[model samples]
Target chain A: MIKGGFAGRILHVNLSEQRTWTEPVDDALARDYVGGLGICIKLASDLIPRGVEPLSPESVFVLGVGPLVGTDLPSSSRMYAVARLPASGTVGWCGAGGYTFGAQLKYAGYDHIIVSGMADKPVYINIEDARVDIRDAGAMWGLGIDDTCESVYRDLDAQAGVIAIGQAGENKSAIAMAFVDRISTLGRGGFGAVMGAKNLKAIVVQGSGGITVSDRKRFNKLSRSLLNSFREYKYLKEWQELGMLKAFPMVPIDVYKRMKERRTACVSCPVGCKEVVRIPDGPFAGLVKHTSSALNLFTPMMYGMQDPWEAVKLITDLDSYGMDMFEFFGLMGMARELAGSGVISLTPEEPEIDLTSFSSMSAWAERIARRQGTGDLLADGFSAVLEKLGNEAKQHAPALIKGIHPYAGPGAALPWDRFGTMELGQVLDPRGPHVGSGGSPTYFAIRPLEVFPKHLKRMGIPENVVDRILGPDRNKLHVGRLLRYSHAWFAMLGSLGICARGQVNRFYNADLCAKAYEAATGIPTSTDDLRKRVDRVWTTFRELNIREGLDASKEALPDQWFRESGFKEYLTGEPLSKKQAEEMKKEYFDEWGWEG
Target chain B: MKYEITYIQENCSGCLRCQLACSRAYARSFQPSAACIKIESRGAEYRIIFTKDCVECGFCADNCLFGALTKTPKEVTA
Candidate 1:
């Protein structure tokens, strides 16, 4: 039996054979790798062979939570879902937090769940305590995420947490995500398509069991002490009200506030950063939906539609169809660019539709989800969209990192508006063109001198290292060194089931996290110990990518970001030449112990 | 005098931390379903309903980050 915080069980479900089995997690594995993303990555490396198709039955999907998840640690409710990304075919990892799923799984006497093989027909997995059932999802198939969740809840427990995909996954859209309780999602990596390939509709978990911590008193004391910091967070009220939207600052707050009906939070989160709005009495009356995200909200606004209600509608439609907002936004921008250059006279299948309007974008998004006509081409991903649109569209096509869309590459913004560390991390991420992989938060763009120490402290870097970086000329501080810390820090958090929100990091550091871990799991861990474990996990991740023949040689930012004109480095306001950019990448790779 | 955890519904962010805290205090485990205080959401609003299981312990209010839940001395006991 597993002691400490772990339930000691690894539930392996094979849909292809419709069999389920439980094995005791090797204590050595937990001791060495920690839990969640760490264990998931280690398992994925061993279970999945090289050159295996991501969507094939041979590919694996691993869901795990850390030892802290079921404890009272703040923001401990998280699940790391990982797979061979169908979008980029690289090692993809998504850390998601919700109110119930991870905790419920832990309470159900499980440390992790590994699913492999494909089901013969549409189905969903139901887990209640020790009982596991692969139920038919024929009736619920093709339903939107919300409806599917509601229907599944009706058939099961209302309290059961549902991680279901919309039609986007059923159709296997590469950009589709696995939506968690209509609140948060496994960020990227085409995990939804992986589920669709398995014919798995949803995973419902409900547990009435208990989680035992090694030292409850110490755990409670440590957790309770952190509450003050969370409450006193400078942006607490703002985050509670605006969440991520506050970080990006899009459409005046008054605009969203008018439609803002209420704010909600994930499981065990002190910062309720999610907002739900209802358009009270308009042509679109009683339309209730949650905001997509900061960058996602920017998509509708880019088309000259500023109405918060309209944006909410577009976001909901995108979610219902299981469309990726970034990819959709990129496609819309490319289409407009193609049309603007007089390359193609844009004519809609429905001639009455204003092809440039937000509604038209929504129409195209829906078509992409359903894979109908023009949506069929666009749904195949950005490269496919460009190919069918011909050479003009290809020229206008935004540079994609690897095969997937870049969230915010250097080309996406003017140099001043862009972040150097973040952009560099984007290309370096094994997942390719993703932000969350590097472990830095979106709020890292704050005034450097003021936030540097705090950022360093949060990552638990030694004061000596901080002095080394910020010494002499703060302008020439090597950002590559900081990126190395970020990679390790994020890898550690992923293994620990910790949420990656800015405030969470601000309130807790590696020292406090070690205490929490030690108290929860009787595993004596210190900052140094955890740091070593992080290095191991990160090295293993890099090794996995290398084994797949995905290395730094293939990494490159868009040409626009490297262009010298109208560009300046974000930190020093100095011109960022192409040679300097190449040198920076080399420095980053060297920090990771990689050779050019 | 009797005191019970009192909730300001509007201040609740629906984080459910109070429920986790309460469950820990009562059940000695992290179980939200067994907690005395329940946070229900409708649109953007959340309602905190205290159940009979509540022992008048202020753990939930004490852990509430937004002061959404609080306990003060009341002269009359229910």
Candidate 2:
């Protein structure tokens, strides 16, 4: 039996039958899968059939938070959503971090909420403690994410945790996403469309119960120690001041200082990576927007949208529509290129495509959300575009990993000149193109080879495999072999509901995590045991995807990556050939004990 | 020297760390609603409220990283 750190119950909601049931969380399940995305993936694999269409009612949506979420652990307010994504047609997981949602769900006495089957009409699941109701969402069906959340707040408590979708999701746009209280995005591979396909609009949760740890005294000691370490962190002040803008110098510091109203952190987080920005003055004056990070709000500048206010306005509009900004921009960039080359032309009645023009982009957002005219084709994402336009369009298409537009790596929106674990993960991970850096050394920075051993040890890589990862040449590190441990680390962090971002996860080591887990859950877990559990979770996740016909052999680096003259291997500083890239992929699979 | 808890609403990042810490100290569990300190959201800003039961043990203040809450020794006039 589970002693603590879990709500110890799983809420299963069947929308088709309009019924709900609760299942006890068994020790075997918790021990094998851990929690959060690990448990979610396991549940999805068991409940969702292999051949079910991604957008069909048969595809299940699992929302889970780990044992550490409701406790006083720093940056533990993360939740994961797993489903067969409509954009990629692959079972994938996406996570969101913010205040209240994950903790509130735990307080409601549920570690995971699994929703399956379709509702007869537009509805939302209102969960307040044990009372779960499928309420009518007729009035909120067409509203934007902000409005839907506000309506739920009005209907329920203002402090209630709400996951809401907008017009794009209602229309089942492949790029549609759901927002957590209009602050953090929950889905990237169109989980929102899956929710929409089920005629679901939102999920509101409120709980009055508390989360207890098995050994409160020990847990408190660990928590306080971790908190103190974060407090003493040298970069804490700068990190609080700048958030992610400190890492990626995308926006001007003066501009960020002028617009940033306040920094916002998730529950129990010292590093507040999220920010609330206001347009101080201009055409879009008095516009207040809450973004996960400043990087997202200023991303338009990377594409030549010069005005900050315009960028904010465009992003806010996109958020309201519940569209994935990365996919929208990717699709638009490709469409604009094709249109300019006369490879694809807009209807005479449709507005001209110009990514730089806010008005044009705004119109395109609406058109795509509503699936109007040319927007109808764009709503289907790259696969449809490739199918319609043929092989010539493939050359102009943006780098798509797992059939979705990539947000990182070479030729992506946040273009990097060198290859890293994240770059490799873009193609390797079942989920397409995410920024879960997994505490890898080559996430966004190039570090010295000497640092690899220390970082690898911190990531819980066994000493026996350390030499293999370092390889015969002590000067160079094998990225693929290192990535195997990186994935396990990411899985472990996600399972614990810990923030995997560098700012927070940097302070966490495997042994510390193991001790904390033992204290919180009363589960006797050694560092090695913790590593084994996470590796099991990742392997099971991969095996499940493989069962669903996700062929590793088919995965490849986009041609556009090699075409870039500046792109080079992060470790070798030499241009990586296609053969070398393939070898790296093979090494990753070989390390996983899978046939390459 | 006696310490008094002081709150700066502007500095609060709405993380609710203070509330969680307060709850843990008082109830041995983490529950924001059970805490003496509450962070109520008013649009973009957060308003920190201390309930009647707050003894001001200073745990909340200590846990607050943004300096939203602080415990300072009372001034003694000469």
Candidate 3:
């Protein structure tokens, strides 16, 4: 038996030197941050150079698979990769789902792998317990993500799993994503672009052996209850049914409603509503493609043109090139608006983004992807795109919150039943609500408010956990308190190496978490410990952001949200003004114990 | 008696609980591609087609409340 949960080692692969070494998986680090979060924090402090210029040789890529992964724990199959994000200028992360790497690392007797120092030429890493190699990827270069993974996995002389990027990453598009198992990806924040910049193609893994628990009887006893709890939860059922595809209807209604089909989701998800449609397959023929809710614009445009192929081709190309789809694509909408006024502004606050010319979805995406004419300005992200359009363009691009564009719209106008505000937790953060790791705007939702609070009290958070995060009156903007708690929860999820997206946490909530830990770690860590660990990870990332360019000023939400959302009390139209937002930020900063 | 857990594409969310469970139950490892229960994914479309060659394993169905995994009403285990 493995005993007390852990593979307990991290492998260091120096691509430049073409060597591999082992490092211990620090237990304290595991307790504080777990795999995904820990990899970034540890690598930032250990591997990366503050100003090495991310695309250069100094940048490092660290991929981690959590300890609970590949275990019988619910949804513990996800693995995370971390590097300095080229687009966001901070910690870059891409996580994928599978047992490939997680099992390999365990078999190899390691917890994670960090690849630093770029190779002199393109190469792929092949790993198996007691075996490692740096193989030339010259033949695999320039291929699409799907083809490349197929090629490499087919050629790799072992039972293998491959993680690769496509021509988009090779092109160094910051929006590019890393492709694992050909389908699922670490889709956000341009991790793929960083990989592309590194001139590396893929990492293939295979291993033998399995992690044994301290006590099989106790583990089985706890897991049965955990599984039963998962089967019993309503949220588990909802996620299993809906998945992330829930973001469809938000596309311009006239455009989306026509071509709508049944929605689906990624591996093992419940919210499978992400729609797929076949439009008689013409120019867009055989174009079996799916877009996230944030990219719902494609379906509608596909409908208008009666050509789903063209729309799919355009955005899928964007994803391949490692472009920040949400921010990059949203910028295109803003640019089309700017072209009409022949006006530009550095900041997008005063004048609303009037994207009248964005009427033609075809031209908007094509131009942005190819960086043609107005599209060139959008190749970076919204902040960069606005700069390219000039100060006048800035005024029109006012929808950004902490430079992270709105992934979705307001509650009433939301595409799905739950607008994800409760899950997204940015109702009050200055970086515009989505920047929050947890602490969602669920305070605005119904029913959940009651149950969630009871759970929090059970977890031992202060009675005011909800009211402080989303409460009116704002006695002391308790953003810090909530941030700490949510961060801890996320940390615990990572530490225990479980997936909160499904049943384990929902049915058992804190109860399941405590037991899962005791079952796995043989350590009786409480729910509060999990939350604190998550907070440590979150706070460290927040600090990383602060080091990058975040300050109290940047933390304030944009004026346009209050304007566009026109958020009003149940009876009053009184907007949560910019001044009020500033007050909230200050209070948050003060409570967080930041000097700002 | 045994029951099979067949993952239906329409209801899966890419959560990989089945695989995680399978890895532990059968493999004692957390590898999905290695698990007896597999999650077939369509990321952009957000669909999962879960398949298990195992003959009627009640464990998966017992845990799948989403209707994503069906017990195959007529399915008989031996």
Highest lDDT: give the candidate number. 2
Best by DockQ: 2
Q: Candidate 3: lDDT of A141?
A: 83
Rank order by TM-score, top first?
2, 1, 3
Q: Which tens-of-lDDT digit does each residue in B1-78 have in candidate 2?
A: 545999889889988899899899898789888999988886788999889998868889889999889998767689
Q: Candidate 3 at residue B65, lDDT?
A: 46
What lDDT tens digits, residue by residue, belong to model 1 across residues B1-78?
346667789878667788888888888888777888887654456778889777776878877876688888656745
Give all TM-scores, in the order shown. 0.93, 0.97, 0.77
DockQ of 3: 0.32
Provide DockQ values for all models, in the order shown: 0.59, 0.77, 0.32
| Residue A352 in model 2: lDDT | 83
Off by over 4 Å in 2: A341-343, B74-78
Error of 2 at A349 (Å): 3.3
Ranked by lDDT, the better of candidates 2 and 3 is 2
Question: What docking tier does model 3 reach?
Answer: acceptable
- Tens-digit lDDT track of model 1 for A309-337: 66667778888766677777766666666
How accurate locally is residue A308 in candidate 2, as Cα lDDT from 0 to 100?
83
**Residue-level lDDT tens digits of model 3 in A1-596:** 22456777778888889898887767667665645545546666566666556677788777776666545655555567766665555554455554344555555666677878877778888777667888898998878766776586565544456678776566565556777655456646567767777778887876655666666677778767656655555565444333433323234443443444445333333333334544444565444443333244353352233344455565555544435545554665565467557664323322233322233544544444455554455555665665555676776674565455655443211322222223224533322334324532233333334355655553435655557654654332233445445545554555455544422344435556666655666554676666556556656766665666656555555555555454432112354455644554565455456665
| TM-score of model 3 (CA atoms) | 0.77
